[model samples]
Target: MLFAHDTEVSLRAAVALVNSASEPETMRTTADLDAFFAEHGYTGRHTGGADELAEVRRLRPRLRTLLTSDRDTAAELVNDLLRDAGALPRLVRHGDVDWHVHAVDDDAPLAERIAVETAMAMIDVIRSDEMSRLDVCSDETCDGVVLDLSRNRSKRFCSPACGNRNAVAAYRARRR
Candidate 1:
């Protein structure tokens, strides 16, 4: 199913980024590989030094908890991130992007920027009654988060691969 709203896409991206934490090699440390930042469209000049990278890396665990936890826990965590990031809404127009609400500045540290954008998108999700789309995969052994945008609410796996694996497992168990 298609997510027709920008906030939905943002939430999906946030979930994908948070789930990246399940594999330490992908994000590694804050100085995160240039390739990673480039792909995620995370742009801002940084000394790319140790401390800066460390803080950005720190955000991974926080975001992970946001994705995997229950509604109450996720709300509290997002609130904490917004507060700690000093988030205050202001409309911004940058490059080709139209005027959109930015809760933080252009050059705020990478982690703060990510937190603000994600928190704002989550607020949109809550308002739009789409919070149920934020979910962990139903597969028993897989802990990845799944952002389901299906019109029929049928999605249950992080990916088609995980879906196939779980389906096969289910079939085998039934046959036993």
Candidate 2:
């Protein structure tokens, strides 16, 4: 694995959150936020409502910058995030997951928890010199983040849909 299982999960969640803000936004309602939280297996105080949803949505741009920045800049951004959140890392295991780090209290606001977790995971990526694993989507029409976790580091699109679209376009061009 490129990183610990929990670290990879956190990074994937962060990428999904960032991509949700792209054109044709997928997270436009409280229900969307709830689904996101559930899908990511987030265990914490989740006050479901428009205000909470807005707070989470506001994190996208900052996370995108962190994910796409150079290694040094990404480290600086992660440091800033951890400092701003007053993060204190500790090991915690809940549900089916094994022991892993949780850097914020369970009662912390969902946005803060999400941010701090993403920042903490980035710590591993930065330290391991795996910043190349995080990248902007290759689809020129989409401004989404792509996490290349494949063994060969061959992932180049944010989603299968984008990859298929580009492939179809290439095939058509070849036929012409």
Candidate 3:
């Protein structure tokens, strides 16, 4: 794999969280946030309140910026996030997950944990010189973050929807 299992998972989670805000905002309610956290296997304290939701929403743009930034800028952002969160890396095993790094307490604010975890994962991306794996969706109309985890680094679209859309358009163009 290009990165550690936990790192890849965290990176994908970060991308999904960022992409959920690609349009007007898919995560508009607590229910939406809950669903997202459930899907991402986020295990921690969640306020299930407006403030928590708002903080998560605020973090989306920052994560997006990191994905689209140059290596130096992304590195700086990651370091800042880690520093800001006062992350203290600790290896922990929970639920069905194996031992992985948890840089903050489980009871920490959900947004802070998310930021710290994402930043820790980003360190692997930067140190491995694999920042190119983070990209904007190739679809012109979609502003989603694409995490290219393929062995050949060939993934260009953020989701199957965009990949299929582009494929269909290409086929039609060739037939013309």
Best by lDDT: 2
Models, CA RMSD each? 2.9, 0.7, 1.1
Off by over 4 Å in 2: none
Residues 1-176 of candidate 1: C-alpha lDDT, one tens digit per residue: 34434465567667767766664345665445455556555556555667766766677677777766767776787798889988989976666666677787778876688777788877766556576777888877777788877788888988777899988988999999
- Please report how far candidate 1 places residue 176 from its true position, in Å: 6.2
Residue clash pairs of candidate 1? none
Deviation from native of the Cα of residue 45 in model 2, angstroms: 0.4
Residue-wise C-alpha lDDT for candidate 2, range 67-135, written one tens digit per residue: 999999998999999999999999999889999999999999999999999999999999999999999
Evaluate residue 36 in candidate 3 and report its C-alpha lDDT on the 0 to 100 scale: 83
In candidate 1, stretches whose alpha carbon ends up further than 4 angstroms from where it belongs are: 1-6, 29-33, 46-52, 171-176
Give the TM-score (vs. native) of candidate 3.
0.96
Q: Distance from true position, residue 150, model 1, in Å?
A: 1.9
Residue-pair clashes, model 3: 0
Reference-based TM-score, model 2? 0.98
lDDT values of the candidates? Answer: 0.71, 0.94, 0.91
Model 1: worst 10 consecutive residues (lDDT sum): 1-10
Among these predictions, the greatest TM-score belongs to 2
Model 3: how far is 145 from its true place, Å?
A: 0.6
